[model samples]
Target: MLNDLGGQGAISRAADFIVIGAGTVGLPISVLLARKTGATVICLETGGLRQEEDTHPLNEVVQQGMFYKGASHGRFRCLGGTSMRWGGALIPFQNSDLCNAHWPISLDELTPFIDDVERLFSLEPGPYSDVSFPFELGGTHVNRLAKWPEFRKRNVAALLDADVAAAANLQVWLNAHVVKIKTQTEGVRLEAVSPNGDRLAISGRKLIVAAGAIETTRLALLIDRQNNGAVSALTSALGHNFTDHISAEVAEIVASETALLNKIVGFRFGAAGSMRNIRFELAPQAEARRHLPPGFCHIGFEVEKPGGFDVLREIFRNVQRRKSPPPRVIFDLIANTPWLARAMWWRLVNKRLLFPAHSRLIVHAVVEQLPSPNNRITLSDTCCDRFGLPLAEINWRLSKEDKENVIETSELFRRTWRTSKFASLGVWKSIEPQQIWANIDNAEGIFHPTGSTRMGACPADGVVDKNLNLFGVANVQLLATSVLPTGGGANPTMMLLLLGMRCVNQHAAGSTPPKA
Candidate 1:
């Protein structure tokens, strides 16, 4: 792949619109903007065109990249962004999640966005089957159970195989790390640097901070700190609220010898065998509910769907940072079980006196956590990246709301599994006396963080308005997954993509370089 500069000019030319990131939201949004108005779109990417095919020592334990058994690297640092690692399965936020009161905007507002993402990605119907998957479980697990060769085709993208940094109208800077975003009342000026001493600055009619959640808010905060006392336009909201989906999976289930369970799961939502198949559900216990009260959040389990990863294995090889050990003993682990697991869930994966199967399944769940001051992102005096930008210091904290979500969701999972009719397949079998589960204390993240530089009623309460334009920063809009006012219970990709497209359409109408 040729490492080409996105635009012809080394530094002289400015663009109508500039988008940062280029992964999830960045990828689709840029495509949309360029397609709609033919704007001089310039996208900046820190990662080079080709991913390092070799593995370093990154682990999944702390949001680092991973290669599942030498497949494509888990996180693509290139043009596709993380979407390259996307499983392509699309699902919307739950109905209960639609009216998130804490959110400045509701799910109804995002409904159109969801539809747009589905259509744009060519999302297959299997993942969104109207009829419940043929399994006894509810409609939630459709992405897991049923699978064959077809499922891999859902949610198509054009990011791969293209000279990621080259485009007809899209000027992409491959190694450009946009470190300083100079916001002026006239327009926004961008300063991007490459490791080899390439420095470029150009103004835009509009700016979309398409960097991922962490990176986007990090830059915004730096802009704030840089102009802290210059009567700058940035409000106190640049990097205030930062939160990600906290998923807790405990290895607890013991299947019966006659369980007849596929090592993982086989899902076929409908005729589109490959389109949708993987599935699972959460059944919380009663005590779990008493511990955490619930109202408007989403809680559930994401069990592994049937089918081994042969098709995507090679795709992930280049981006994976770790070569994960082959998983043994397929057992069932509950999502949102971190608190209970830490308190009473099992973790010492090697104990044998009371162990059951060699293979195990994970129950991944995402519950709601309210935005709090403690969980804010801040700028650091040190820790700069390869670019001259300061690395962000994330002070992630678990609130009472997070704790409540876990407890209530865990209790609900216990109930659904043991009592529901769908639990017939050895799901509720009590283990032997010796093999007791242990409880966990805190739930960690799933990289689905959002709400930092949040959208709010005004500058006093939020960073950007509903349009995602920064409160006081003129001509600069943030487009990554960071603008969500209320964190949705579902994966952030679909909604983020929707918002990005919407913003792009708005910019294209009267697009130019941003006001300084």
Candidate 2:
């Protein structure tokens, strides 16, 4: 059961395992560990049970190098974490992503866990293979499908099993913000405080820091400082090699045949009620030859003008929010009844969201960033949060090579499309690289922060070893996007969850965790 730390004193102060941050990656692993191994587990969440619109004050940070909207946006501290606000897109990393020396483990080693991760989300169990396209771009590009869960299934917290929640061995505590870690002789002790200023010290035989990327690095830095740099001296690569997926709209397609365009790039409804869409990425051989980082391009349809459908959507939202619809909304809905009826029919019969009668098609592309030591996270000397702990200072920037990769990849995609038989169906308005660079703000990170506390084969290069154990800290492991050495073109959520389950499984089997 979910208990409030501020008001509850019935639960124990310690357990066999203590997981910080009951977010996307933390909640499932905690439940699995408790249910599978029957080990007493406690999960600490900093936020309440519900999602909120405004950013939390503690999430504020100093942006020293680049303007990162994710630093203050899209992050939630609630029980569901950012999964509560995400679009539910799921894609796995390519084999080349792992084989390219970006990760300590290869794709073959991680393949066994993919189906398990998919099952956790109730997705169809199978390998996510490349689908054959109607028109091919020779050996250069491959069409891959990205799956999305139904809207109701997106919040991962709702997917937890009732039996697991009611298990006597598992407890989830909310509003328990951990601020300090004390390394002890046997294990570590965490000192947490509630919003009401109630203090609690929780100790465990093992600890897992599954907070999101930036926050995880910040906490690791805090632990290092509290330990008089003992941790950093061993794991020197703790707060370095930061990376994110940089994306931008590289071109606009004015299609003469909307139906063909839709068939080429529209969202497909699967028999299992999930939505799928095709994205174009370079073939493995082509990527290897180009010597560029991985990236992908997808089609984006924009509603050219607001119609009755949009007004009806607004009215529905207003009603759900318990607010009365405005006079203009009612007037507009009445004015376009015919179009509204057509849209409703299309939605019901086609199982697809209706686009505007005339919509613009955009070619959106996202490129993987080369990890750089300069883009890192550090603690601010002057800035502190409400807990009086130093705030994280994010020093992130796109290098010149990064910008050139975007330009080259975008051009390569355009050239490949031009070679296709269906090229004449659309008029392309391509973007110039010079103009794109001049307006560099057009390109931005997609909120996938990674590589601060990266995994390495040895402690000299990474904070965690192959088993994810902190190098110098016994009985403590770190799990988050921060442990990812590279952010591939695919979303990192599935991979992060897979790693979390792997960690739990290793622990369940009585495998001795690596020591410093």
Candidate 3:
């Protein structure tokens, strides 16, 4: 049942399991445990049951030591968590993803949870597991467009309108911000501020901090400070090695006929009820030859001038940045043009406006960021949010290896395009040799924050064990992209959900309550 935290003494005095943050990651764990294990689960959400006017303010964070401050805006502070803002894109981790050897747990460990993840997302499995796609590049092709179902309509609808009246063991407390977590010999005690501004303490036998990457790191830092070197494993790794998918539009691919493009990339509807846009990456063997990290590049098929859409995007961005209404000319253009008006309305209803189909391929590259100790999140020295807790300061930095990967990968794509029969030399224009990599201005982080509280077999390498349990804290666990040791080239939604399912299964299999 959902309980409003604004009322006096609304929180339950105790719970068997406490899950902080009722977003995509935390919600599944809470629901599954309550249903499968029949355990009393308490889910504490900093946001409300639905969207609110004040949602943006709750996400206020201090971004320091970074050129880009977009990370805070990437996170949504509502009941659905970031999933509220997610596009519902999902992709499985490729076998080559294991090449980095940064992932403490083998891919096999996560494989068992894939079926559960597919079921939860209403997907058909097996397509992603195919050893190779039908894209014909003579084993030299680096990319293919695969599809996955978008989850906003399917998953969010269930969570928002869920009738949990029959779930006696589950309680979801909304508008309750967990400020501090204290680990004790028996369990964990969470200090929270209710909507009514009252201090409340909630205790649980097992604590799981499923807050997103930034918040997860912040809480770890806070807990580390409280323990005073008792859990030094987290204290050392909690705020270090933060990373995201560094993306850029590096080049374009032109084909004489649309069907000819099929030979280069796979475009088929899978049994999963969604189209797969399997992306391109540096081949594993080629990657080893080039000494490059794993990364994926997405190519958008455009039927119209891509520049026109970009211009409109920049205009809207400027208007939003200025926080002012659009000029009268903007309204006049849309008002006079029926198609423009329809596009604007569609964009309002859906975050993604439907772009007119085109045969021209626009290549956008997203490279895996090499882990850097210096690129991290730390407790801000001066800034604090509305809560007394110190704000999180990000020090995101790119590496020399990252630049080399982009340049080399672009060259590989060009070489493949030149050799391929479908891509006519007349239709395709070669990227200037000097500008092998895309302009730095076009490169942006895909906002897949990961590796801050990474998992590893040893404490020296990471903050959590393969099971996602904190090295120093016995009863506390984590479920977020923050625990990912290596950020792959694909979007992280599916893999993260798989990780959550694994945690839930492990906890349920034990089915033992902490001794009182």
lDDT against true structure, model 3: 0.68
For model 1, residues 1-516, the per-residue Cα lDDT tens digits are 223444434564488778887676776676677667767677777666544443212111122221112112334556556654455545555444434345566657666665566555554433333254334433222222222223233212243235333456677667777766787777778887765767778688778888777667766776665655321264666666676655555324444532233322322233333334333422222233233322222212233442223213333332232223243312212332333243222222311111122335434345656667666766556665555555566666665567546544544555555664445544543322222111213334555677777877777767888788777556777776677765654566666766776776676776554334
Off by over 4 Å in 1: 1-10, 53-76, 125-130, 133-167, 227-234, 250-265, 269-274, 277-358, 399-401, 429-443, 508-516
Worst 10 residues of 1 by lDDT: 58-67
Rank list by lDDT: 2, 3, 1
The prediction achieving the highest TM-score against the true structure is 2
Candidate 3: where are CA atoms >4 Å away?
Answer: 9-12, 52-55, 129-135, 142-147, 150-160, 163-165, 233-235, 259-273, 287-290, 301-360, 424-426, 430-438, 512-516
Residue-by-residue lDDT tens digits, candidate 3, 241-271: 8888876656766656544354334334445
The better candidate by lDDT, 1 or 2, is 2
Residue-pair clashes per prediction, in order, are 86, 0, 14
**Per-model TM against the reference:** 0.72, 0.90, 0.83
User: Whole-model lDDT for model 2 versus the true structure?
Assistant: 0.78
